[model samples]
Target: MQKPLAYRMRPTSIETIVGQQHLVGPGKIIYRMVQAKMLSSMILYGPPGIGKTSIASAIAGSTKYAFRALNAAVNTKKELQIVAEEAKMSGTVILLLDEIHRLDKTKQDFLLPHLESGRIILIGATTENPYINISPAIRSRTQIFELEPLAAADIKTALKRALTDKENGLGHYSVTLTPQALAHYASATNGDLRSALNGLELAVLSTAPDPKTKTITIDLPIAEETLQKKAFSHDADGDAHYDVISAFQKSIRGSDTDAALHYMARLVEAGELVSLMRRLLVIAYEDIGMANLPACARTVNAVLAAEKLGLPEARIPLADAVIELCLSPKSNSGISAIDAALTDVQTGHSGEIPKNLKDAHYKGAEALGRGVDYQYPHNFKGDFVVQQYLPNNLKKKQYYEPKTNGKYEQAFKIQYEKLKKLLK
Candidate 1:
């Protein structure tokens, strides 16, 4: 049976592997290891179709080691033993273990001795974080390397390579891909090179040749139909989900409306209305606090509207909120002040509250000098009084460093500085 174009077009060497320059670029860690032939057991983790399998296969091909691929979850311990037997016969064998996070205890125990002996250079591939999911015994033996999602340019590079390579690609077919069609395959799949290449193959094979010209012309519409415009799904348990969420919040915080909308669109496509709603509320107070009070209130209203309307229509209100959030004068004063106070309390810096501030209504409270020194701020001028509010240890500690980014915060700064001066 013929293999899929993606499988057939796998990079057979480190230099040929596209993207992941941080790992496989010249003078990078993986490249250095390949150059030295000192291949160590390492865990490569990232989102799906982002060169995890390619890196493993490429390393084995480049090193000329007896390479064997097996799934840790599906393969039995006896299957691992067969790979071990091969390692023993050939001195060293490069073993690509897929789903290493799902590895059972028995298989882990069997692989441990071989990994330690340097007889099997274990390359564990996973979409989950090895530090969080894999056992310490397996983790301690391997160096973990994270693989990033391929760039759109990198995806395009791989797609072109597959189109022109005669041996393992669709080079023999007389297919013409327009630039627009090529971009759709690269960008629409969300950095998945495998999807782009497979989409290309589908476009080429399914398309018919021109009667006279005999050329299979793949236009933008054909490419889009072939991939059906892959949408990024939000997996609640997956690591990539959090990464996208993080980017969403940060883009709004950084006041990049375009980027904020981009990440928001991704969440919207995944039907993550609840997550987007909650994050907007947090961003409103934590990022836009005091700087634009009206924007914060409007954000609340937007979220409420979104909740009532739900998706399709929910995306509208959510987009409005994110745009205002991105353009709002940003401040972290509210969250920073609370966090500073929390740090002190958590670190045991909390001292006793002054006696005057204690509850005076309680029985026997007057005997202990509880409210004896307390002044009535209502009776005082400007409804203000100099009094110790914080614990004694934190009397001089300043937490709220207000930003003067907007008119609202400018008014707050004036009042805050006056209060500080009076207290001092």
Candidate 2:
């Protein structure tokens, strides 16, 4: 039996690795270290299917150091001790621990003394942010290398190899991928080579082989069926990022619960950070303004709590906050109103500060009729002295528009009406 395309097509040498030229290319930091035979303890941080485990394996194979692999998810303290004993006998051992973030503090601490002694070189791999997930003491002692997603071109090359390389690839079958079909596969994976190859293999294997053509054509529809989900259509760097976020914000602001949740699900499913979700929550308040003041507080608390609780459990609190924010009363332009007023002053709408509002420390200002005609609101009846606060060029501009929904807005509306009546 032949190995799967993903396993069979694994790059044995650094040169064959699809992505991450920054770390392993000629004269790069890790490349130089490896060439000099001075590889150090390190951490490989990246999302799944980005070659973290493969890179570690390649490093072990290329180096002369005694290599031992352990998974923090399965290995216990006793197993670690045994590995340490082996390292002691070997003098120099390279330990590659996968999913190192799963290790408890005690297990991580167990490796500290060995790591500090320079006896065992440790290389840890994690999908989470090292700053938050890993212990600071351990992180400080290791060099961190981040691996980026494989480019579409890189995935295409890997796909070609999978079709041609017989030992482990799809060489046994008559498979010819069309340009459109390959694009579909590449786009579906979103830079995950494993996913791309798996999808391609399934598409090719399932189709009936034609005797005259002797080739299986994998179309976009076939690939979609195999993958089950459409690829993320938005470009991460382009306007699509902002557009999606704007839609997400608007959905929440408009009180469209389904639309808001759908966008949230899209972001989360795309592997967006919890921190980004928290940021959107803050904007919901600043944009929503007084209409939903509690949304801001709720969002802040969710972010802080998510940091402590971690996912997949932390997702619950985040979801709660998202739903609450979407349902909260909406308001428009509190921060924007203040910002617009400041812009007018800076743009020379007001040539000088009002003398009444200016600092009293300027002695000449009082002599030049600077301190004139300013009514103090607190000293006046009902604390409601009506006076012009805007620049002369920008008068009677309304900034805040509160939506008539939810209890908070109702209360605000009542107070605003009462204040208007009293001032008149």
**Which candidate gets the maximum TM-score versus the true structure?**
1
TM-score of each: 0.64, 0.58
Across 1-424, the per-residue lDDT of candidate 1 in tens digits comes to 8899999999999999999999999999999999999999999999889999999999988899999999988989999999999988999999999999999898999999999999999999999988899999999999999998787789888988888899999889888888777766766666688888888998888888999999999887787678875334322223444577799999999999999999988877755565678788999998899999999999999999998998789999889999998998998898999899899989999999999999899888899999889999999888988988888878898988888998999999999998998897
Ten-residue region with minimum lDDT total, candidate 2: 231-240
Instruction: Please state the error at residue 399 of candidate 1 in Å.
Output: 14
Query: How many residue pairs clash in model 1?
Result: 0
Off by over 4 Å in 1: 230-329, 332-424
Error of 1 at 314 (Å): 10
The residue pairs in collision within model 1 are: none
On the 0 to 100 scale, the lDDT of residue 420 in model 1 is 92
- Report the C-alpha displacement of residue 21, candidate 2, in angstroms: 2.7
Candidate 1, residue 360: the lDDT equals 95
> Model 2, range 1-424, lDDT digits (tens) per residue?
8566786677766667778899988888877777777878999998677788677666766776777889998988898898899888988788889998888888888999999987888989998888888888888989988888777777888888888887778888888666666765665465678888888878888988877988787665676677664434534222333455678778877778788778767666544444246457666666555776777787878877877886556667777877887777666646766777688668866654555665656668667776567777899777768765555454445544545666777788788766555444
